[model samples]
Target: MNIYSDLPDSHTLGLEMYQLISDLYPICRSITGDGVRKTLHVLQQFIPLEIHEVPTGTQVFDWTIPKEWNVRDAYVKNNQGIKVIDFQKSNLHLLNYSIPLHETMPLSKLKEHLFTIPEYPDWIPYRTSYYEENWAFA
Candidate 1:
């Protein structure tokens, strides 16, 4: 589309766009929730916006909108009750749509839900079970 064709392709513009990406990177976002609202609010500062709130269960063609899902905060603590992994540090550490888990489980059992990128050992992976009821760590 020739919509944004008026925008320049200059290095300064690229840097400004990068800044916006950096600003949005840390937000814990999902397909639905306040994170999405917070994101749109941020965008409004740079552009005109007309926000629309679609209720849960609203039918859009053959699909039904699911309930809004938001994670105020999530973390996994060790046996000693010390936080080992947190969503605040990296939102990708928590799988999307993970139900609240606040119980102690054996590490071996927990490993079944924990995921990793074997090829890229240094990187944390992102997983989702949006259409199903499941939970995991990344």
Candidate 2:
């Protein structure tokens, strides 16, 4: 189900990364807890999920659900001290799960883990490591 924007008409993803998501699960999968609930809610229009909600800090085995990182905006400046990338323009432009850091380093060091797809520069190549901790410009 669409949340921030209108749901696309088709159920198949396109060659592009953005289209892939909608193309695949127009009515399935859990992109978020709320997204999951919304999907299941739609299914309840035919079936049900008997869903459950766990409070913050609740632990299950070795993993505990994290407090959602609803970042409205973020950005980084170059060594020249220029704000090159602004997260406010796009949430997917960031390295998700990155530790809170605001220091500057040289271009050589900074570009190590940076992700930039020249073939699809217009598309923010969304990357994440829910279980890892390394951030870079992409």
Best by lDDT: 1
TM-score of each: 0.84, 0.52
CA RMSD of all predictions: 3.8, 9.2
| Candidate 1: 10-residue stretch with minimal lDDT | 64-73
lDDT of 1 by residue, 1-138 (tens): 799789877987999999999999998888789999999999999999999998988889988877778987788889888888888889998889998887788899899999899999779998988778878888
How far residue 35's Cα lies from its native spot in candidate 1, in Å, is 0.4
**Residue 10 displacement (Å), model 2:** 15
For candidate 2, write residues 36-99 as lDDT tens digits. Answer: 5665665565455687777646788987765443344457787676778876555566777655
Model 2 pairs in collision? 12-23, 13-23, 115-138
Candidate 1 positional error at 105, Å: 0.8
- Predicted structure 1: clash tally: 0
Q: Which stretches of candidate 1 lie over 4 Å from their true place?
A: 1-9
Task: Please report, as a residue range, the 10-residue window in candidate 2 with the lowest summed lDDT.
Answer: 23-32
